[model samples]
Target: MAQKSFTASVNAFRDKTKAQMRDVFSEAVQDVIETAQQPKARGGRMPVDTGNLRNSLASGLNGSFGAPSAGGYIVTLSQLEIGDIAQFAWTAPYARRMELGFFGTDSLGRTYEQPGNHFVGAAAAQWPQFVAKWAARVK
Candidate 1:
């Protein structure tokens, strides 16, 4: 029947869309990892938990659904620092308005006594652009 054929087509389209979203999330993680690498460093690469990044993005998208911030996506980067502390506590600090925390600190420590400026490199610098790109593909 035509109804059966239409159902199959819709299912195929859904599958394809899911695959595309996954690809987008993977690329976003790759972008963060690549940007985190320090060129002059000996290893020339940094170990990033990309799985976490992927999960975070998925969670963000899931969270965004039916809520005020629904359809929003997040990718976490842990290598950047401010002074003696790792700057990004949750996700792209320099770019996204997100939760932040400091390493080797306490509930009330001097590490955050004074606010400091943190920067995300050119690739991961724009939060709005990143969000918009993923939102369009997330269904």
Candidate 2:
């Protein structure tokens, strides 16, 4: 029947769209990871002490915040759904202090004026551009 044929077509289209969206989102997250790793003098925005913070960056779907990767890692995009949320996070305990800065000593008794890095903020600023770039890739 025509209705059955149309239904099949619609499902195919939906599947394609979802696949494209997942690709876009995955690329965007990768871009953020690369951007965050750039050096301050060069292009890196994240603070680097032991490199743990840099390695802790991760992107997960549906609020899954797993342990930080030894290196950069991204969730498999095939599991992404049409309405799933993509979240990027740093699992480091001091990630907040690095981003927001700490002007005083901590419980560890070692601290000074640590200015906010605004690293993630920098990547987030590119969100509009990411959307635009990826939107064009969608069919």
Best by TM-score: 2
Question: For this target, which candidate reaches the highest lDDT against the unseen true structure?
Answer: 2
Q: Superposing all C-alpha atoms, what RMSD in Å does each candidate have to the true structure?
A: 12.6, 2.7
lDDT of 1 by residue, 1-139 (tens): 9999999999999888766655555545445534433232434322233433212322222223211111122232222112222112223222132112234454566344323222234435654466467667666
Q: Write the per-residue lDDT of candidate 2 for residues 14-78, one digit (tens) a residue.
A: 88877887788777766666676665767577777677887777666787755667343545344
Clashing residue pairs found in predicted model 2: 38-44, 39-44
Candidate 1 to truth, TM? 0.37
Decoy 2 TM-score against native: 0.76
lDDT of 2: 0.73
Candidate 2: list runs displaced more than 4 Å: 70-72, 76-78, 108-111
TM-score of each: 0.37, 0.76
